[model samples]
Target: WKIEIFFRNLKQNLHIKSFLGTSQNAVEIQIWTALITILLLQYLKRIAKHPWCLSNLTASLRLNTFTKIDLFQWINEPFSPPPDEPEIA
Candidate 1:
């Protein structure tokens, strides 16, 4: 019962009037769709493994450590320093 309704809705919305002459197009579309699905799955798996890839490091540090100032300084020290600035003559 439900399957019939679902098929009717899918046919109406997808405009699948007739499958008589769509075998070739369907094959090509399915191939591209499968390729896209596989690529997206692999990309997401790689991202999941790297927790620090897009995380808020400062928040994680604060949660793990006792002192806020120490964490702040540790994270900011590199950006605060001028790596190779020469002294004034």
Candidate 2:
């Protein structure tokens, strides 16, 4: 069924092998978070100029999470260096 495919995608992309909490509310929250994450990633992929596969894009994001670069620019041109800042007066 389509739902099985959806869960498979979540597990493969998000590495969500097990739920973090046993309570129903906690499980729902975790699933919702993962769903939101997938939607956001799909949006980024659609908007990016570069032809990025989903897994690669996800990995690149994880690798660059702390880097100080413009998000749009980085997504469009991941290999390019960040733009230089003007010197402070």
Clashing pairs in 1: none
- For each candidate, the alpha-carbon lDDT, in order, equals 0.46, 0.92
Tens-place lDDT digits, model 1, residues 1-89: 97676446435433345544468998567546544644543454344433432124423443556633443344444234434556899
Question: Candidate 1: misplaced stretches above 4 Å?
Answer: 1-22, 50-89
Clashing residue pairs, backbone N/CA/C < 3 A, model 2: none
RMSD of 2: 1.5
TM-score of 1: 0.31
Write model 2 residue lDDT over 1-89, tens digit each, in one string: 88899899988888789899999999999989999999999999999999999989998998889988889998999888777899999
| TM-score, every prediction | 0.31, 0.90
Q: What lDDT would candidate 1 get against the real structure?
A: 0.46
